[model samples]
Target: MGPTPSSSNDRSERRKRNAKTTIQSLEPDTLCMIFALLDFFDLVRCSAVCKYWNTIINKSKLLREFYAKQKQNSTEFSNKSTCSETSLKTYLEELAMEHHRVSLQEGLINIDQWKGHSVGFNQCRMKMGLILTGKGDKVMRLWSLESYKCVEEYAVPDTVPLVDFDFDESKIVGLVGTRICIWRRNGKRSIFPSNEGTFVKGLCMRYNDPEAVVGCEDGTARLFDMYSRKCSRIIRMRAGPVTCLCLSDDQLILSGSSLGSITVSGILSDQQVATLRSRITIGGIKTLCYNACSHLVFAGSTSGYTSCWDLRTMRSLWETRVSPNVVYSVQHLRSDKSTLVVGGIDGVLRTLDQNTGQVLASCVMEGNALSSSQNTYGATEKRKGRRLSEGTPIDSIPKSARPPITCLAVGMKKVVTAHNGRHIRLWKFNS
Candidate 1:
């Protein structure tokens, strides 16, 4: 129908409007600026707007570019600052490195069947291939490397064995009641602290001298002279119930107490150097390992956290949640100490990078029935029961048998882990 001239003019005026913005209307730079300004949620929201925005969002390279620009901006801003944060650069690399080493993907080690679970549970240490163990409280045995057979044994009923002990190439020193005893291949020597009632909690041997330091349950650290068979000196600590001790050469000693305080003191004199605190150590420190090359101190606490400190400044470099259960031991296996071997009450073994405390590899150290015949089929189900493809789990395999790993000993081509009770497992490395 034909409209009146006045109505037609009004309709035509209403139809005439300004041009609206469209997906193709924006420039690349403008679109990137919008994306840069959007948070993750907003970016996702933009993806839902239309097919044009969805294509750009799916590129993913754009988000990476945005991050690069932000990092560049941070660098320029830091250059103008008077002071800088030392740990800021490290924070950028907090994401752990992913290592797809074939050994780890495959099986890392094979159990020596002949030596399988022969020795009962005991406190043990390994040097070279020889395993030094304290059996019960009165006997000690050195196991052979290849055969896992006991080559030498030492015992003294008069010397009561504590739950733990310390050893070296030649001798093993143990805490018996209030007295500390040193046993060798042939004879035995004992040193009695002044207070027989004070329980010995930790022991550290001085390599250069015939002396060792003992930390007592009463918060006192005593130096025992192995040659003189007497107490040398006692260093007092305000932190109660000394728990662990680590010797950094003959001159310097580090002691951990029940309160989560670590004190650095001299072995010869009572001169105290520094104390590194964990703020509140949920479970006093259970174990400590020091890397001389990096000058990094690693302490494992009962609370299942592993913390590393730089020795130069006495500042903690980093802390990481290592396990859900108590961490029993931490040891540096590599010569460069790029990674550490950690054993915990959770029955897990983790290989973590030293610099960032990033876990590079992990596996269960619990019960397994792998034998010489079974290992021929490999560890995982990659070749066993998979349907001609990798990355698939086998429904046939059962769970691992587990108990807490109390100690660990790593070699050039082997790793030995001890149970808290009386089981020891040996693993041989391929390459």
Candidate 2:
């Protein structure tokens, strides 16, 4: 009998109580300093220790600034609330809880997939709960994001394939051959055709509400007024064919050419501002996107490199080879601009650090269907031609038949990837 049983139990309880107080006893500033050294996921885990830790982690301004790049004083947030200002912590909490069901840092799982088009899906865009997809068959289909059912379909002339398309809440616009095709969502009158611009053929387009900028095969960008259905201006890039276009609210137009040069021009001035040239001159620029918050512009090349340019100084920030072949798509999260996602011919999805161009994570698709428990979604119609591996093992499929990722769209915590085959994949990440 070294000690009575009751006495021993009391001693253990005292130790457990003291352990909780030990962390709470530290001054808030000291605790903040300790938490500052921890990474994002570590801090999230630490918050679950108790109420004290959770409150501190949520209230810390430093932590919010490190994780959430969104500005509290921005017009979108400030104009919304008339009584009180929205804090970064609240914004972060909303995004973490509502939007980001999974974390991209850890890894992604192929949870759901389906056949998106009869032919290959050439381009896609997602908004709200709807997805708009375009194919080389001159057909554009709109699908419900949740059901994976084709809600509506629009078609152009069979002779001309759909080049590129974009949609908002109101209407859908596409570059069909030499004209700008428009379809109003209300279905009052469909296919508002624009005046045929001087360009021979359109390669790509970006819509800025009432205005649409169409990049053409003639190395020229024609700005079209959507409301009036007229071509406003023709800005000459003088590079090869204009392959991609990015529009900014600051009245700047960035057009990437097949000749591997990106020309920045002002909308009002209608003159060339600057040119961004990548070190790899052989590959043409396939995609271009602008991040207004960071004043950064991203360009993906057919030569497998992705480059970033700072609009403030008009200088190249960083460039890194993301793929062995063409990088067809490049997109970043709206809430967090630090993580950049790239996909292309390699059939691999990669996440990169936008600031340094460092590869953070890579995920390869094998085209094997997961269990029904993992993914309940499947194509309603059977794929007509050569189907993706389906339940077949990766080792069985030939490397040459592997489908290239033609386009991709990021939504919340999930990523939807379209391929040269009929199938499209959905990947979800976990914290």
Candidate 3:
């Protein structure tokens, strides 16, 4: 009488079957897509859903590719590297605990203690017991880390506000605006460009040759011969301003640009052989570093992403976004342990293990009342126009803590972070 009771029961069974998602029924391509997005925990949950789903995942090439990348990240990059699942998982778990005991190990050349660098709108580097810093007035100061005293000072007559700088034992190279100035024990030399508007954005010293590859705002990279102090060769790319550059072990140059392109080319050759483009456009690549053993390029973008790319296959093995803001610095060491360290405009510092694309350590570069007081008067005043352009709410975060990390240097298990506020902090991690 109730409009057929059997009809209602049959309808209920049909609903039950429709409510369940059976992986076996989905097309192979669809199932693979679902598996691609599932991370470690999600994959474990999927395996428990049913045997058919588990079988599909185990047999798919996607799983194999994932494992291959995991293995590559854990071991030192070698053409002949292999790791078992147990080994990869064990290494990542250990790395995850590497930075748990992190603390403010030492404060070296900080704004609170040493007041030599007047304007503080520069960069800092720590090696051995020496601290290298660039400041206003076109000056570079080398200070003793232990004593926090300036042992040596070098100034380029009138180069105000160094955009970037680097050094080896013999010479210090400073990128002031768009010009490359080399400061050495003997004298200072500035490389003149033929193009009036040619500004050098970044530069990297080559390992095999006595040359420095400089990336310019005009989408050109030039190799400067250190001995002759002249531009040796020119490399042109169809991208935007060359923002960063790095040299691989085999002497290949990997350059990043503001237009979200990464170009690879040989210094001796004339053409850009390969280009890696970011699909999502994370504020364009701002920094580049290399891991020689793995032949992997670590690229940091203004959009807070730090990605690892494979040179041999020309494929991205893994990528990660480390912060909600811009990544200002990226670095990697050529050790068996695959650790990629990054710092950014958000003051977020992270150490990532290449093996699993997981974060090994994360901490913020905190500013003190001194850094706050100093930056309030100097750093902010210089870059007042662009401080609030990144969509970051500065007023809400407190003035003392909002200075973006400008640069970073690593040595002997220690990491040194230089901020826009003339603060330099060092941290130590135990193996």
Candidate 4:
């Protein structure tokens, strides 16, 4: 009993009519609300579905309101200008060039070069700043960012080299071997004893609190009360070292490990709330960052990829292959959460869109070649090291080329990238 051709045609027409009627009856305000719930990438795809969707999305008032709300908490939209399309394009280009020129100076000597090697920046109270570096000097050097000069250099007793450093508004924290040191802004320094651990790999402070979290190479992440200098809680991992950690505004501690797993735990209860496994296996997780505005968590791998996960849903939002080499650092642009800057073993710095995983722009590092194993003194050492496949140099390659990037940090006005050649380049928007 097969249906006749006429009956089949009639059924098909009715289905089409029903769909059209449903779409036509949807209110513009309701459509706007629906779009708001979706991510930027999903919204873009929705707009292409039909003419009705396009009309709602193109409404100036709706788009303006959405962008304004995003700007309130995100730094990404702070620098955007509401000008004509052509004018906006021109402005962005000029801003990119300005950021590239001032921050990416090549073949020049740094005025305040120090002995030893790894360098980091810390925000200080009263508009002051600190820079920590290592070598045989065995000292932490504090610097003034306004004057671009060293203010104080505190010496450490032992010859143990600094493994990691972090700071907040009130104090500076440094980890040398297994011991953790806390120094107040007023110049008091004290070392806190920890159970036997080879290295402290990650450090982060809780938002709006004096408490901090530290991750070690022994697969354990612990929360420490900075005031009391006591371990408050500990979250253990399965295997591999805990490489990077970040604390959300709600006091949720997120940790990424070399075992290709990301775990989230509540600080107060010290309970494992959620966990996500990597889509692709890598050497280890190198860096992690959180964007509170979007509730997005980003994890970068030693294998050269960055993965984004939604904190609320505990599901992967998107993952993109950033570079061929290992990704060392990842930071969300304060002005725009949609934009993220990634530094990797491939000496080039890339800015990507969070929703679509599209690269916005890339800047290449042009300098002398340096070996990967070269540590503090830029000299080869025999210690255990992470390895990545070597890629072509930035200057000799095209704009789309990828090169290795060692470290990255975002500041109030600029984003800085540290290259293998002991080069630190800053990037900022021009307008």
Candidate number with the higher lDDT (2 or 3): 2
Summing lDDT over every window of 10 consecutive residues in candidate 2, give the lowest-scoring window. 381-390
- lDDT digits (tens) for residues 1-431 of candidate 1: 88999998988777765557675788766786778688643564466567778777656444334333555654544442343333332322221111212233234545542322234554567775588766553666677775566777666456444545666677777666566666775655544545532445544322334766676677777777767767767887545766777767437678776566688887667878789886445467888878787788888888888888877788877778777758888886534447677878766666677888877666553243443332221222111111112322322223243357777876544556777445456655442
Better of 2 and 4 by lDDT: 2
Error of 3 at 199 (Å): 7.2
The predicted structure with the larger lDDT, 1 or 2, is 2
lDDT string for model 2 (1-431, tens) is 49999999999999988775666689988999999998765676577667888888768844555544345444444333443234545555555643352366563354565766667666778877788887765677788877777787777777766778898888888777677778777643244443444357888889989998988888888888877777878888666788889987799999988778889999888899998877656378899888887888998998899899898888888899877789999987665567778888876677778899987776654444434322233444211112222243434545543457788888766777778666666666655
What lDDT score belongs to each candidate, Candidate 1 first?
Answer: 0.61, 0.73, 0.62, 0.59
Which scores higher on TM-score, 1 or 3? 1
lDDT of 3 by residue, 296-333 (tens): 77788878888777888777767788777788888754
The best candidate by TM-score is 2
- Worst-scoring 10-residue span by lDDT in model 1: 380-389
Give Cα distance to truth, residue 201, candidate 2, Å.
1.3
Candidate 3 residue runs with Cα over 4 Å from true position: 1-116, 159-161, 186-209, 365-402
TM-score of each: 0.63, 0.72, 0.62, 0.60
For every candidate, C-alpha RMSD to the true structure in Å? 24.1, 14.1, 23.4, 22.7
Q: Could you tell me which residue pairs clash in candidate 2?
A: none
Off by over 4 Å in 1: 1-107, 113-122, 135-137, 156-159, 187-209, 279-282, 365-400
Alpha carbon lDDT at 88, candidate 3: 41
